[model samples]
Target: MPITYDSQKRIFKLDTKTSTYALLVYRENYLVHLYYGAKLPDDNLASLMYRGRFDSLSPYNPKVEDELFSPDINPLEYSTNGAGDFRISACSVRGENGDTVTDLRYVSHRILPGKPKLPGLPATFAGEDEAQTLELETVDSVTGVRAFLLYTVFEEYGVITRSVRFENRGSAPVVLERAYSACVDFPGMDFDMVHLYGRWAKENSTARHPLQHGIQSIQSKRGMAGPNHNPFVALARNGCTEETGEAYGFNLIYSGNFAIDIETDTRGCSRLLMGINPTDFRWKLSPEESFTTPEAVLVYSDAGMGGMSRTFHKFYLNHLMRSEWAKKKRPLLINSWEAAYFDFDDDKLAAFAGEAQKLGIEMLVMDDGWFGNRCDDHRALGDWAVNEQKLKGGLQSLIQRVNALGVKFGIWYEPEMINPDSDLYRAHPDWAVCARGRDKSISRYQCVLDMTREDVRDNIFRQMYDVISKNNIEYIKWDCNRHISEAASLQLPPDRQGEFFHRYVLGVYDLMDRITTAFPHILLENCSSGGGRFDAGMLYYSPQIWASDNTDAIERLTIQFGASLCYPIASLGAHVSANPRTSLKTRGNVAMCGTFGYELDPVKLTEEERALVRRQVADYHKYYDLIRYGDFYRLTSPTDNPFFCEWEFVSEDKTEALTTLVVMRQPEHVFHIQYLRGLDPDRLYREEETGEVYSGALLMHAGLNLSCVSWESPDGDSLVRHFTAV
Candidate 1:
């Protein structure tokens, strides 16, 4: 049992046995030495983040630390230790000789030139000199587990991002079950009751993580100035489920400010964003489990957006995303449920795809309903094999036509679901996720597939990749129609029933890996119902998601906004299309972000609207690189600033800029205007509206009264401003 701890330095180490697991993270800087769990220690514990220990490299000096460096005071907080800093106090199980009764569980913070174990999380800073390249390595030798860190180092934008990845490469297969909490010292916020929300699971901002029975995520009812700041915080519990199963994940948090990005991964192979808490980790774990390989955590951060993050994560992700790739190499162009409904015929599909080809949209995908003798949404789910009646020909013939259209073809399949009328289900009714002995419930007229069963998983893979392997298909939209998490699979061992969700996902990854290995060029777009189950885990395989079925451009603003907060924009499936929102009459900015494509009939729009869309497609190509790889910044808000919201993409140079300022008219007797900062700080900037010149700070902080006196932004119209450094 290798262990190490540094109480005096407020650092902890576990590289070797006999090394004390003495570190405990309490409140910001106060790490307690828990080497002797039974004994109450002395000055062994002091406020590390407070009094003066901000960091070893840059010691915290209350006098020198600005609001940017110092921890912002939390409004609602009650530490178990009766100390405000105790809000984050944590301790490991008492040492072998110590009693948990007297010793406090100490949390570990990574030590700079020392072993402080806060582990490189990320920097929550905005000032020019506040950023740092902080990294941490956490390993459990006894368990043979490891997590690594790689963080972005831009300090001016007021944030630091770190990505952490971990794996259990041990001898004994063990599940790494642990509770991760974001115990913020921010007052007004309730840690116990605060539920964290982000892009890992949602379509628009409205789609949120499933709640844990009695909790609502901590959101700023009012922003920082008003009463709170809402940074993305998620508490996930995961570990090994199989002997040799490999896993990888990432998390991003922007502290110091709510909306600004601190780090992002733009140069890496993954093309992701945000930050990591760990790095290159080999879990020579469970020599008995059968699997052995190093697991990794990817940490990315941004000044909100820039490099690959800002361009892709912040902006482009919402407009255009590069899929995992295929034989032909391009996104599998898709016409989702919202596009064709049940109106597609083989000839119609081929003719319709003709339009997609005119725009360089690669693989043409047909989503929903082409299976189980199905004609509508209500039937033939989970039923493998194509419905001959719908296509009037076998699946291969239809695919050939799409291929003939000079485009690769993709088909949607929700393998995890089954319709009661499906041949497979009717033969094995119990295969669906239903309450054993009790009637089962179904969503979207289907039940979950018992993927835990080897047979089920095999059946899915067979039709999924095997069918495509036999045909000219190059892409697949893996759709999960419903959340069938509760039903018990009689086929699984009792204790393993709980392992369904994670395993189902893992199975998906395995299937994708196999398919990609077999085809290498076959791309995948994971869809859950519409945009459910959108997460980084899935992204490693499925490069894009169906976004949301909501076609309203206005609602998309809020939706895409929430989505961009966690995931890089490259992952969202956004398109420019028809007006009059489909789901709810709400408006949307269908043109601004994420995989830019159209789901509407290009022929339906008026000539002017069509012309506008045509231009947008071209415009996307113009800034595609910037949007795909620049820095992202939130300039406005749909929150209190609902009348307008703004975002910007700044080149790494800090000189060039591309700003999207959406203006919604308010009856304040005026029009919409945008402001910016760091624009030469003192240099004069020319306004986009007119040849107006003004000092950068004056307009950025105060205001640059702008009036589109001639016209106001349509109730939800936005003005796209492309900036260039003079």
Candidate 2:
């Protein structure tokens, strides 16, 4: 196995029983040659998805062992001679007893690009236990060029950590400039796309390349909150293919200098390339340098985040979650709308949490009905105050009391809205996004607050901060019910009415940014009537989202399956079993592919049903780490691969990967579980329930087959196999 990495002294060293040799020069930032031990065809970076940003003339630094590696990680060695490739040494990788460790595991490499790429570009990872900051200075101090970087070649337990940071340095400063682009090259996909955002019904601009067709890209203004936030959400899936290779398959290009074009390859895969335009502000030092806003270009690879492999990818995200226990992930949690809709109160809330706790739940969130006049969601749209009528006490007191019971407390809030009937709306009246001359009817009992306005921004921010600060609130169900309507006003002038959606989203970001900054300890879940706002823009601010309002497991299967194509599992909110799913038709396990949680009334469940919930929790607890943070691979899409949904999560080293096969037998059964990809060439694993032993070799080569399938598991109907290397 060749576990390679590069710094100033770049080199690739392979490990074998016979001997170890340093592979001669290939280009830098190239890993295919390093991992596959193949020669680069022509050995050039011109076609390697080139990302150029005069603004981001810096490098991305990789974390060295001493800098961040845990016990599972050993540092790089140092050579006898100081700094040349032949002389550049590793930090002497030693086993637990300093023996030449032989059981080499992970084979990895990284191209740590430097910065101008501002600090704090939103990151995605699984598992928790976070350090306070991500401080990697990879730029050349003299030239202001960023080249410092690091990568790991693992030898211990697959536990890995992910983090990123930028510590403001130098006297005269430069504005941060960065790009969201991939480094690999692939063949391409078969379809065109329209990147989407805004309302599903009416959307904004659809991005396209110079000359294109059928496929369009929708740039969503939806976002998780932060200061001066510009959401980076645009799609391109033209040249990437799943049929060709792994790692170097798909990409979304972001040209830091040119108009950012979001494009895909020949496969059906997608990417949201992001970059910032040069702005001279936010700079206090140096000659007046240029600045570009950061973009949200996030994509999830399914291979890195399930089962034990999730532990490997955890290294990429520790900066955000900041909690080790949180990294372990909790039981699948469920909320009420999918369970009882808008049901009971305090005692009711307590009952749900208690029952959930019995079933291994870690937290309980009080959804819509617990607030002021919120029964059925028609009234109290702008109200932030607690409804004494429902909880019988203030929100803080209720939360405090709930915490005493050993369960975390979460609440719902929608500050960017105002029902004209609401007191705030009644008092200000001008607070809504409406026009005076024509008309502004209501949607969902309220209108959106002109989040684009400074005052409106203040009001929203203050109230939101108040809720998190004053109360022991651990989780927030941040919701934005209706999309921008009437397009009249909040803060923007009349001529810029069309700018409402974009600016309004900025306002939302401002509020959320403040809340999260001040209360870094809290976890926020974003929901816009479920999948309505599922996009990369929102993922920047929210760790999880309400996958969909439709709780019907069957319908959810379709909805969530479509959603998984873009988002990662950690950000995808799902539950175990909910009161017989409420949908057009009775369904099967609707939520088995996300941060599993329940939203049902514990008091209402029968003993057997409750036990089922408990069992579901156990299943979640067992696999939570695997699904929440591992790489997400969408093997089959209901839209494309109906009747069969196959996916897997592989550890970083690719040693172990878990695959789940969901078989929908409408009447196609020629089973023996063969003919699937990545089956154990060495096949060593077993069915958790059936205990039927198998070889990793046969499993990977011949695959397993199933006939007479039944939708039984309340956890979701599927075949889950854990492939381990013995």
Candidate 3:
């Protein structure tokens, strides 16, 4: 059992494989955090709590004998507003009496065998025997507000997911100003904050900084989990490395506006809070109404960043993703967006599919421009009808032709967008999202649809269902090319206008639920002008996402490296493209690290290039299983190393390994030695190319020597090494 209770000490100890989290019922009612770190055998962890006397300037002044203790100086399990805790709070409400304080005390707790489902939200779920959940209920005596803090412990992965549900029991309605998912307080400020930050076409670049005295935070208010910042943060010890020391990771499973804040107080205590961003966010809770926040996954890794990443990878792969294709090897696909943009016709598409089939590609995805007047980026976004002018025959005919050529067919749709010139928008202009008296801003030459409206969502859902159900489509590249601009909706009341942003996200989730449930067999890949919407929320609907628009191999090294911090490699959609700036071998090697595919036109390839494509496809199939379900190790970081980048995938049994080494900028020395990891030290492994056997211990400890000169190209050099246990 992962959860155990100590009635004598009134403490709850939750244990995972490598860590233990302890909570105590302080003052017999107030729940407070005790400890969370490396696993301990004993349950007497209450001694870890602060025991010193109150300071002279304390908020709990004069030591009142009968009053509740001041929470400003105490470590609270779930801090709430009106409790005098001035830092980041988990919940804040404005009651009808005009008071904003909520002091909740422990009521009761229940332990269950498996994780409980979070209503209307995406969460990590597991088998009954694989995990356990603890639901702790607390109530505020003044306002009759009840909060249920739910925690699920994955014993094997050392991960605990936290979420909160607040119910209003008072007669009058209360407005919730802020509601966060999880909060963790550390005793000292001796750690560094690490987050993923970047912009469009260069998503998920790593950034690390020492925690300061004040608040250090990362957030996204661009509606979606914007490419500017991802919803992941890690606290690492000062001396932590990739393979050693302690690291704690907090990842939110949401796609809307989010905030992760870490505040170091004057007392040196650090509090980390994560959830939906309070900026431009508010929820109205009437009598008997309840609100549920999204889940935040917490991981404690004593083996450092690599271990932290592997833990997240395993958790997401085994528990978070519910799609049938989660564990299946993804098909090798070729997309037509970059190949022909919006200019290709049915014959051109068929020709591309024929060439792709010849190269062992399993699927051909026609991206954009297949629907109503979508000849360019400016028009016909909401119009989902087939463009007979471009296809000559309807979409079904083209799909059938592609399917007959030994290739599966997929189509793309930007269902959340509307072009002003589109027929759908011209007919129902009110369906577009806009403030009542304001001119709507445009992005990518399109306006966002008012998904907050059920009618609009239903109409779009019907259009998507009609296209997907009528055609023999094997895949769907569901895309959202723009962000919310004038967020207000005409249908919403004045007091409810602040709900538009979060409501839009809920609308997206609802639509996705309908499509995914109705068409369970189709492989779905989510994209937002590339990786803008890439997060755990989207991963529940689409197993994979287009990592970014920039397919340049050199640029991808940093992008993929940062993304691996929280997301698994299988979730990144990487493609080989014929960028004049990069070599084909380099491109293929980089793309191989992700869900491998092609983004360039194969028909334009020369004989030699076509042969290379065949080899790439063969290589993809050869090591498909290992790459899809392996323990990833980051050997070299592109952001840290200026000359080269290296990484590897080692199978669970340590029997097979595949490594890619890329030379970013050639150094003076032409020879380099690469150290391998996650191998059985005592076993002997043979390199596939050279037929030379070496001890795994020696390979991991000593390393492999490669002649960079042989792999050098005009742009850069990329070499992939495969090894098998012998």
Per-prediction TM-score:
0.64, 0.63, 0.98
lDDT of 3 by residue, 349-391 (tens): 9999999999999999999999998889999998898899899
lDDT (tens digit, per residue) of candidate 2 on 1-726 = 324324443444433221222322223222221121122322222222222221222222233212222111111121111112121111111122323221111223342222122332333332222111111223223223221122222212222112222223333333222222221111234323323233332212222233232232322222222111113232233343332211111211111121223334222222222222212111221333322223322222223212222322243244333333245454345465555567676766767777767766778777777656777767777767677887777776666666676778887777777877677877787887776665777778777787768887777677667666777787778877776546656455544454344345556666777777777767778777665555444555666767666655545555564444434566667654444433211222235576767665666767877666666666566655656655655555454544665666655444555666665434343443433344445546655556676776666565565544433322335566665555
Instruction: Give one digit per residue, the lDDT tens place, for model 1 in 380-472.
Output: 776777778888777889888888878777778777678887788878887776546777776667777776566777777777765677788
Q: Which candidate is the best by lDDT?
A: 3
What TM value does model 1 have?
A: 0.64
Query: Model 1: runs farther than 4 Å from truth?
Result: 1-336, 359-363, 581-589, 677-704, 709-711
lDDT of 2: 0.45
What's model 1's lDDT at 326? 12
Sort by TM-score, top down from the best: 3, 1, 2
Candidates 2 and 3 compared by TM-score, better number? 3
lDDT of 3 at 235: 97
Error of 3 at 532 (Å): 0.7
